[model samples]
Target: MKTNINNLNQKSIAVDEFFNNALFDKKKGYYSTKNPFGKKGDFVTAPNISDIFSEIIGIWIISTWEKLGKPKKINLVELGPGDGSMAKILVRTFKRFPKFYSSAYFFLYEKSDLLIKIQKKKIKIESNKVFWIKDFKKIKNGPVIFFGNEFFDAIPIKQFQVQKGHYLEKFFRKSKYEIKEFYKKAKNSDEKKLRSFNSLKGLNFIEYPELGFQELDKIIKKILLLSGGILLIDYGYLQSQNLNTLQSIRKHKKNDILKNIYKADITYLVNFNLLSEFFFRNNLKVKKVVTQKFFLEKMGIVERAKILKKNMNKLQVNNLERRLHRLLDRKMMGDLFKVIFAFKSNNDDILGFD
Candidate 1:
């Protein structure tokens, strides 16, 4: 069954609720209605930019599995696997390591039904090896490795601002004339929760992942019980900055967020520092956060690219070089994107962090 985010007829809803309906309403929502990947779509992901990116992730998975003592039945879940581009390559890359491939069960934890259909079409494997799920209740097993590229940012979040010792939460009230943003008195509980987090201190503006945390709460429970980790790579900041990063992008161009409600991709930057704080609070060990460039270089993406270039023609080599630069260049995804891993284990030797 599809995750219902239907707040359509309702006159007013919270910022996160509006995002949920706009991006994932199961009908006419951006993700539900169209494919938002590649040149034809709103924007392209790293996997579509280059397969080597996914290959690097595939390599990381194997190495991490080894660190986990090679569990007999390891569960690898890709959170919010967009377009299934990365997961498709991961499944193929795993085939080379036959032992690991057979031992691993691939799970795509997705919410968008349209994307799920697209993913199923792209990953045409006829085996019990792969599955799609909305929750973690089914995976009652040895260990679970949950990873996602550009996942958490897509989850809806609540935004707030502090004014003259008064706390107010942002909401989008869809009135008959037009849709506009207005601030309402925030809940006392929300204010208290914000104050409780040390990572969110001294900020006039706040973007709290209210629903996002609820989602992670489930995953955190699974990790504590199963002894595995979650690796997330997304565009976010490690420093505590009071900037509103909420954005709407379509065809690689930014539009006023409220302008294109259910037509454009809505997303915000993930706060790595906040994530670290939350993970620690949940009793999970977090690896040192690193840039995409740092993580990929440590994972040997440069070396992998060199090996691929040798077998390619001049044109192919040039294309490969460009793609590699995009992935590693500080001006592009290299510096803007960040990598973080949180696991419930004594082994902090996971690759791509140090």
Candidate 2:
């Protein structure tokens, strides 16, 4: 179905326009205004789902911190910390290791002003120990441990479709109020890559978040400069050649991505393979890439769940089992979501993947 643009203001915008206006316009954007989360948000994240998720990550972080020589001042950086639930759990978990907690500095790179406020309320961090910045560039150089959960997918991506051996961009014409896919001669490199993909047939569309890649490159450089490491967890394929992964969610239900504009969450699957290549080219060592099931299972998610369920009633135990299964089920988020770790130092194998 086509979008009804006639009823919108003459300057009515598309999702990309709204995002660009909000993020880059300097004058107006949702990030500059308020927090969007919980039941009122476009979608939910793993941290919002259960404390178990963060508990596992907390263990991972502490293990990694130990490997990093237990630095006196480590930068604990989280990108797009939604509502700070994970951060709150992480800090609480780290408190068990008093030395680590005392030596670490927490930093959140977030764009949503509203979410930042909510995060402040949710996480009780000392003003001198915790910081929030709108961009990663503001982060100071140090021994860094970075985390990005379902972050890259939310970044805006440019969409393209192959037509008669040519590539065309998908654009939203404000006047037309309809999504339009038009073609032009593809760039030599882009055309070469397109030709390499024999699986794309008929009216096939592909989205490449060049901006996301660029941002990743910058972050990687920063991490390398600081002699740091990063852990990225998201739902994406390892290959670059694929069809459109663009999708939307509203009230936990999938919706046409082009339907509601900014009213819903818009995202596409991440390409971890491309991301790995980007990091490898920058001389960063890829420690490992594995499915969430394998990672969490190695991290003893089952054991952890059992411990949490030991005191619960039959119904509670059943619910906990279901949630654990859902989290680790191959057909669900387990296989779809991948975990990749890249480090500057050649330490032993990571806990979850080892």
Candidate 3:
């Protein structure tokens, strides 16, 4: 379903707008079309990679709930919960902490109905307690400990390139056959950051997470209202810089972004620097960004693995070991994926940050 741009009376649109359409256009969006996860799909996530990932996250959730005074009823929300593997594992693990498990309600926010069906099949343990939210309004105001793994990166990003000391916004042209760049002056409050980066020579490229920032702002408000915290894990740079991280993945292999719109998963690296600044400016408590390896290690992944290996067979142990290595390998997800935490107050020290 190719959108007719001229029919909408538009010759060109900003990069983020184009990306939003290609990924969430209802009829032709990548997520709207089919399941895009696992070995058969475009790529696999940490949760799908191994249950150990979610076990540690489950521990983090329990720790956060305890820190939040263990509210009788807490809303445990997961944004972009693909296939619900994480949620399923989390519920199973929560059974160990009966107080937290019984007090928790699962709220999932997913845009695709097809994937939602798959999530339903995978998530059967807490089916009675699970609620699918169409919008943030449906989530009741309570202690909300939210998790967003690789969620922010999927949000559309606007690309800007510096040319001869002038910033040009990248835009896709439907009138023509190629992408176009237009010289547009900065109009946002964050223009000061641009001025600071002006001294860098050569072709400087930067991505602005305007939509991601807006979504996070809304999420922060929800968490703040409930006096709760958020754990966001994704592959990105801890410090912002002039570079392009837009990438395309098809069947677990990286491909050209321009290959086919809405056919492959198109995403950009998240800017934790901007996200941390947003949280701080809003008076939310921000934790020091840590690598996934550091965060998982702090959450006791190595210890957990040791305990599980005692009961597993030889092949099971080997597979488990491989998944663990992939998760902590410095050359793989370990150094690349970063974790950041934000909360409403600084009362209790957040786990996995130290």
Clashes of each: 0, 4, 0
Clashing pairs in 3: none
Candidate 1 whole-model C-alpha lDDT, 0 to 1: 0.90
lDDT of 2 by residue, 148-189 (tens): 888887777766777655676554544354644334454677
Model 1 weakest lDDT span, ten residues long = 1-10
- Clashing residue pairs in candidate 2 (N, C-alpha, C atoms within 3 angstroms): 22-29, 34-114, 35-114, 35-115
Q: Over all chains combined, what TM-score does candidate 1 have?
A: 0.96
Q: What's model 3's lDDT at 67?
A: 82
Model 3 steric clash total: 0
lDDT winner? 1
lDDT of 3 by residue, 281-322 (tens): 777889999999999999999999999999999999999999
Give TM per candidate: 0.96, 0.85, 0.91
lDDT of each: 0.90, 0.72, 0.82
State which candidate, 1 or 3, has the greater TM-score.
1
**Per-prediction CA RMSD (Å):** 2.3, 4.4, 3.1
Using lDDT as the measure, what is the rank order of every candidate, best first? 1, 3, 2
